[model samples]
Target chain A: MEPIMAIVVGLLYAAAIYMMLRRSIVKLVIGLMLLSNAANLLIFTSAGMSRGAPPLIPLGSALPDGPVADPLPQALILTAIVIAFGVLAFAVVLIHRAYNIIRTDNLDQMKDTDT
Target chain B: MSLEVALPVIIPLLTGTFCVMLWRHNVIQRVLSLVGSIALLASSIWLMVSVLREGHVVMYMGNWVAPYGITLVGDMLSAIMVVLTGMMAVAIAIFSLSSASKSHERFGYYPLMHLLLAGVAGSFLTGDIFNLFVWFEVMLIASFALLILGGERAQMEGAVKYVTLNLLSSAIFLSAIGLLYGITGTLNFADISVKLAAAEHTGMVDVIAVMFMISFGIKAAAFPLFFWLPASYHTGPVAVSALFAGLLTKVGVYALFRVFTLIFNQNPDFTHELLLWVAVGTMLTGVLGAAAQFEFRRILSFHIVSQIGYMILGLALFTPLAIIGGVFYIMHHIIVKTNLFLISGITHRLLGTYDLKRLGGMYKARPFLSILFLIPALSLAGIPPLSGFFAKFIIIKAGIEVEAWFVTFVALLVGLLTLYSMIKIWAEVFWKKLPEGIDPTPLKEGKTSGSLAVLYLPVVLLAACTLVIGLHGQPIYEWAEFSASQLLNPEGYIDAVLGGNRP
Candidate 1:
């Protein structure tokens, strides 16, 4: 399962890079989204994966009763996902505004600020 | 145990949230931000004093035990960084009051700036790598908003590249953190340091180090990864660009210094050597890039990259004195670079453009402003009795001590070229007759309705800071020495974070 997940993560990253290299700004946004998910999955799978009890304490005990899936990666990935979502939302709006004014989605055409 | 470590982060966070609520009232927002910045500056100074009195100050968020929960540690480096961030915050906040447009203020510029400051403080104060990522995102988002606040076409273009590259760096940074956690099963800086010391995967450790390097390299605007910087930085409003110029890349350099010194020092032969070459490349490319630019702010933007190289050079040398040089360089560069940008804005206000080809006669027109510009300009070029000279001298002297003649030579050469560019700006903008194309009479002073005098406040204050640090280099050098020692030996940091036997 871990190897398979790693392969999937690699594919996602490859696809992200490919899409990001496209000239269109929209593709770049898509690429960012894919890249972020790839990162989340990499974090998820790189830490060992297992089907185990939920991270819950039994009754009033101070700790979980038995083996449980590592909760840390999930928490970290969740945070990454939320942050990525916010950033992606902003990128979409920014690109939209840029496109509206520049009349193009081609990234090369948006070089007005560059020397 | 003291709450001082938390105050720098909390004050800005609370102020930012409150300002967001008061966004409807620009006057209230203005007052709240000013008060907030003053409070932040005071608290950061207090944090520095406390750190000076009692080594490392550690605060476990939510009373969580170290290694099990998040920690905020302020050693000399973090303490001074927070203070520097506080100073820039106050300057930028004041500058924004007079510079940001009504529409921009209406769109929560104050709130976003405060939020960015909070993120900067959090990044400096965090004792965990993951928390640093969180803070990076926090600040990156706020910066994105600030960059495009005016929604001008050029701004949108710059902001797109800025956000894309920054988000990419953040993703890379997060991925690295995950990989590190997987290796050590810990996220706390101290815990990871201890764990990595004994960890057997030497090859993987090197890989992770490079990953961290690339992640931070992008943010630091190091050579080969600094394209996004020049593309985006000069496109923002003066206040926004100045704040970005002052604090943002320094955060990346700070992270590089922190991680390499603390976690990755076990294999300095490989890592520091790579950093040495990187430093040389960054310095050369950045200055040459600046030398080619005609725009005022764009040239300053590229110079930021070059100056970063000197700091990294200090790090690459990996000696105690070298790191002190790096630390001092950070302090000096922040003030000088920000002041330079503010002066560029002043030039824009007076001359009506940033193009050097069309600007002139500032020496005769406004001797005061030219003097203000020259202070930072000369300091940047490593002129004696100025901040830049001290910073460059220390770093170059450290390189010579290490017998790294080549890099030392390159550093000196860059200093000469930097002087040339400074003179280029001086000759074009101030010394030569007012360009024929430019209006002979200064256009009604301030671009915005607000007083031009307000815009000069930060520039003047920062210039004075450069002078004070330049003349009184002993105390700052001593403080940086102490900071360098703290970084060199992370024992105090580790103990403060995970010693379990603390009060």
Candidate 2:
């Protein structure tokens, strides 16, 4: 299961990097989104996925009774997902503004600020 | 649990929230911000005093023990950074008073600035890796809004590149944090150091180290990863640019220094060697890049990269003296770089442009302003009896002592090149006569000299700081030494943070 997930993560990274290399700004945003998801999955798989009992410990015990799912990576992935969403939203709006003003989604055309 | 460790972050955060409410009343907002900045400075100074008097101060959030809950630790290094951040906040806040456009103020510039300061303070003081990521985002979002506040075409374009690269770095940083946590099962910095020591698979740690390096390197504007910096840094207003130039990238370097020294020390020979080469590359490329730029701010932007190289070089040296030099360089660079930007703002206000080819006669016209500029400019170039000289001297001396002759040569060469570029700015913008067609505009032409005088205040203060540090170098060096010693021995940090409870 971990090996399959690792392959999926690798393919996602490859696709994302390819899109990121494109000159179109829209593709860049899409690339960023994909890269973010790929990163989340990497964290998930690298942590060694466990589909087992809930992470909650019994009231009287200080530890879980049996094999338990790791909750830390899930919390981390959720946080990353939210932050990625906010950043992606902002990136889209920024690209939209750039397109409206500079009249292009092409990164090459956006050279006005460069010396 | 000392609450003073938390005040540097808390004060600015509360001020930002309140200032947001008074956005329409610009005067009120400014007054509140100025008072808030003063409070922040006071708190930071207080924290430093306590840290110096007592050893490392740790504050566990929610009263939870370290290694299980969030921790805010203030060793001397963190204290110094907080103080520096406070100083920048005060200077930039005062400068923004008269310099910022009314429209910019009305749209909550002060609040965002305060929020940015909060993020910086938080980053400096946090003892958790995950917490550091959160602070970086906090700084990022505020900086993004501040970058595009005016919504000009160039700004939008620059913000696009800036935001894209920064978001990518954040993603990478988050991924690294997640991976690190997955491997170690702890987010606390000290605990991770402990866990990584006992954990197997050193290979994964090395990979994550590189990932952390790339993330921070991009932020610190290292070679091969610094395109976003020069492309966007000069696009903002002078106040915004000065704040960014002063504090933003330094935060990245601070992160690198912290992460590398604390958590990644397990494999120094490999990691520090890689950083040594990166330092050399960053220094040469940055200075060479600066030599090509004719614009005042653009040249300064490149120089920021060059100076970052010097800081990282000290870190890569990986010795007590070298880390001290790095810490001292951070203190000096923050002051000098910011003062230089503030001077550029003054020049822009008076000369009506940033292009060196079009501008002239600042020395002849405003001798006082020229002297102000010369202080920081010469200091930046590492002229003797100035802050940069002491900073470069210590780092180069440390390098020579270690017999890392190649890095020392690169450091010296970069110093000379930095002097060359500073000379370029001075010659083009000041020494040469006003261009034939350029108007010899008086400093008091449009705005009241009162407001212009306000703009000069921070410049004078920062320049004075450089002069004082240069002349009175012993205490600062001692402080740097103490901080460096603290950094060299993570045992003290772990004991202070974990209270000797080894999990």
In the order shown, the chain A TM-scores of the predictions are 0.92, 0.93
lDDT of 1 by residue, B223-292 (tens): 7899989989998888899999999999999999999999998999999999999999999999999999
lDDT of 1 by residue, A12-75 (tens): 9999999999998999999999999999998998877888667888898998877887899999
**Per-structure clash totals for the candidates:** 0, 0
Clashing residue pairs, backbone N/CA/C < 3 A, model 2: none
lDDT of 1: 0.91
What is model 1's native contact fraction?
A: 0.67
* Candidate 1, DockQ score (0 to 1): 0.78
Cα lDDT for residue B257, candidate 1: 93
TM-score per candidate, chains pooled: 0.98, 0.98
Provide the lDDT at A31 for model 2.
Answer: 94
lDDT of 2 by residue, B225-279 (tens): 8889898999888899998999999999999999998899989988898898889
Give every prediction's interface RMSD.
0.9, 1.2
| Candidate 1 off by > 4 Å | B443-450, B501-503
Provide the lowest-lDDT 10-residue window in model 1 chain A.
Answer: A46-55
DockQ of every candidate: 0.78, 0.72
